[model samples]
Target: PTTTQAGRAKPNILVTGTPGTGKTTTSSLLAEATQLRHINVGDLVKEKGLHDGWDEELQCHILNEDLVCDELEDMMEEGGNIVDYHGCDFFPERWFDCVVVLQTDNSILYDRLSSRGYTGSKLTNNIECEIFQVLLEEAKASYREDIVMALQSDSLDDISRNLSTLTGWVNNWILDRSS
Candidate 1:
């Protein structure tokens, strides 16, 4: 199927959520399924030397936590891109055709964060971010309600289904936009 904005040209889809909720993984899957370029904001920041000297603490807490729209607008140009990041409030809603916010249970989130080798305060903030719905609320507040899609990633199947559903949605959006 085609996307709604296909006639206008391609559009971006942001896959966002807390760290342990599988934003990157789900975005990767959606990218592959939709044949869209995967622009991982976290990785792009590192690649562009935006965080060259920054340590993990500064990366997560300072830069990422307080991101702004100008930063995102600079990273992505007009076209279809699958942006995977933990935050979504920065980018303009007009630039994004859709957003998928992944969610997970606290126990599952804690296990995922702990297994990542994060310790002390770094881990603490992330856990709190997950528990507090920081990304979710941010997305909700930043965009129209219909533009955001929430998915719960409780297991492998959940991730797979979310990816598949997102792919289908993108396809439908494409078709609708073209027709």
Candidate 2:
């Protein structure tokens, strides 16, 4: 039987993208609108004391892919989680109903990163990552093509629309799975 919207099971969602692409913003919106638990990986790492600083220690820890996977699996076991991260390659496709990849104009991304205190090497590297479509490629390779989507997040209205579209998709996912 189909549950009422109030009793609907929230599907696991992966909101990912390159830096300055609004992954965090979109994930927050979805969590607010759908009442799902928001699991921002950055925050999780911080709370876990996984890394000490942004130096080599932190860099090495964050780059440990296996550790990230294990931690994510543990986190998702509680159910109804929105895993907000920068890429999707490490996550299992079977666990996620949808993966929304947020995208932004290169110029806008450069501006956003610049305003956020990134400069020189860091900003240039991220711009290159976005240009090369690293996150998009990761999503495509790691997830079922039909479940992965690229969305533009150039403005608040765009984010709102994306959130609505994704929420509706989650609802449909639940209905389809139950049938």
Candidate 3:
């Protein structure tokens, strides 16, 4: 059953992109504006030990996808979740009403990643991911095309625009649910 069918008044949104693309910032702001719950998957993975182990080369955790899904299943069903993560393919397609894949220019992304101390293969791999639009492809593959969108996050203005756009979408969703 859908969240609406389950009597949930709000929708679940997935905010995904390569590192430094502002998934957390966007999700947090969106959640604040809409009074939705923001679940930063990276932080949840770390805090809840929802991963097999850390990948030293990647300088990140090896996410246990099944565990992540299991942990989020209930909340997702109840709706009103803003899930922020880099990877998207592993999540259940039914979990999100909207899947937003944030895209950033290579040079801008490079600077952001570099400032975050991302170097060597970790940095290169992420830059290449953005260059190739890997996350957008993953989201499209994992969800219905109509529900997935790629949004720019190259500058503060872009983020502001995205926030406004998504907030309006949320309002429309609520109205749709009511009707």
Model 2 lDDT tens row, 1-179: 53332343557888889888998888888888877888888777777755544665223244455666787774465457888888678676666767888888899999999999888787898899899989989999998898889999888889879988988886776677676
Give the candidate number with the greatest lDDT: 3
Cα lDDT over the full model 2: 0.79
Each model's lDDT: 0.76, 0.79, 0.91
- For 110-175, candidate 3 gives per-residue lDDT tens digits of 999999998899899999999999999998889999999899999999989999999999999999
Candidate 1 regions with alpha-carbon error over 4 angstroms: 1-7, 51-77
Off by over 4 Å in 3: 1-7
Which pairs clash in model 2? none
**Quick one: best TM-score, which candidate?**
3
| Candidate 3 local lDDT, residue 125 | 95
Estimate TM-scores for all models: 0.84, 0.85, 0.95
- Sorted on lDDT, best first, the list reads 3, 2, 1
For candidate 1, write residues 60-159 as lDDT tens digits: 4244433434555533455678888787776766678787888889888888988998778877788788788888899989988898888899899998
- Superposed on all Cα atoms, the candidates' RMSDs to the truth, in angstroms, are 4.2, 4.6, 1.5
